[model samples]
Target: MLWPDPAQRDRLVEIRDNLLARIAEAEREGWLGEVEGLQMSLAGAEEKLTQLDRRQSNRSVVDLGIPAPATRVVGAVRNKSVNSSAAHTPVSLP
Candidate 1:
């Protein structure tokens, strides 16, 4: 349920690179326990990067046009004021 912070992208990439380097060193020294722990951390960092990528992709803008009025105002008819009843009539949109 945690939202990804865009500001942490650079830090996460750095952490992933560091983890990869540590994993290589651990494997060379035959430190199986440390290698397993580093692998788990690396997985977490990579998952966060994936989340940021998804967030970036979904940052498009969409336009929702203005709302229409329930009843439109009609102009005066035959140089006389419009009837109150006619003025309050609901308009149907196409």
Candidate 2:
């Protein structure tokens, strides 16, 4: 899942801690390969948690009864002078 719910977040944290412990144990036992793999997995988990946190912080569900304000289009394509000329162009060419 791209963004997991609260329960999934809890599970991910639990799994991450377990993997970290395993990585430490592997390092103590001189199993460098296993430790490397577990470290990569832990990094992935941490990244996912960061992404989820960012998404949650940046999103909001607002309900405004009235419509939103109209947006003004600027730049070459939608400038007032260009828009006036563009409006006269025919859709289909003979």
Candidate 3:
């Protein structure tokens, strides 16, 4: 999980709080589209905050300390014949 710096996190939270307050006022003003846009913005900010919180937590992996998931082949390579002498060759698209 990616974490933001303290100053950045504080700024984001401040912005989110301000947005929440504005959302209340917007509700009174009946700005439906504005409310919708602000809600999306708030959700994004909240998501980032959640990710930051996760980064701060001390989590233990249950999968035996595996850093990543296993890779599975989906399809075979299109070009199997390798030409070492033409490594830097570039093709022009029509």
Candidate 4:
């Protein structure tokens, strides 16, 4: 499962805790089917958390060198001039 939002980690922890409690209750009540399903869900949650840990640990920063300020500013001005001139040009539809 892709946890895009950072808050989802907390939510996942809550879900895991709830599942544990449900599993315990199921076991006490002798609900074999409920116990089996909840156990599977708990396993999946644990696996997702493990995957998240591995992903976090493996993260590394890559440096793509920045362009010079003069080059960027010149290019932006040139593009704006071109765009503005095109917009204001009178079109003669024959």
In candidate 2, what are the lDDT values of residues 39-62, reduced to their tens digit? 999999888778777877889988
Candidate that beats the other on lDDT, 1 or 3, i.e. the better one:
1
The full ranking of all candidates by TM-score, starting with the best, is 1, 4, 2, 3
Q: TM-scores of all models? A: 0.67, 0.60, 0.56, 0.62
Q: What is the lDDT of every predicted structure here?
A: 0.92, 0.84, 0.83, 0.83
Please state the error at residue 38 of candidate 2 in Å. Answer: 0.5
Q: Kindly indicate the candidate among 1 and 3 with the higher TM-score.
A: 1
Number of the predicted model whose lDDT against the real structure is largest: 1
The root-mean-square deviation over C-alpha atoms between each candidate and the true structure, in angstroms, is: 11.7, 10.9, 14.6, 7.9
Please provide, for model 3 over 1-94, each residue's C-alpha lDDT reduced to its tens digit, 9 standing for 90 to 100.
4566655898899989999998998899999998999999999889888877777785666666657877998988676468955777887899
**How good is model 3 by TM-score?**
0.56
In model 2, residue pairs whose N, Cα or C atoms come closer than 3 Å (at least 3 residues apart or on different chains), thus clashing, are: none
Q: Candidate 1 lDDT (Cα, whole model)?
A: 0.92
Clashes of 2: 0
User: In model 3, where do residues sit more than 4 Å from their true spots?
Assistant: 1-3, 59-94
Candidate 2: misplaced stretches above 4 Å?
63-94
Off by over 4 Å in 4: 1-4, 66-94
RMSD of 1: 11.7
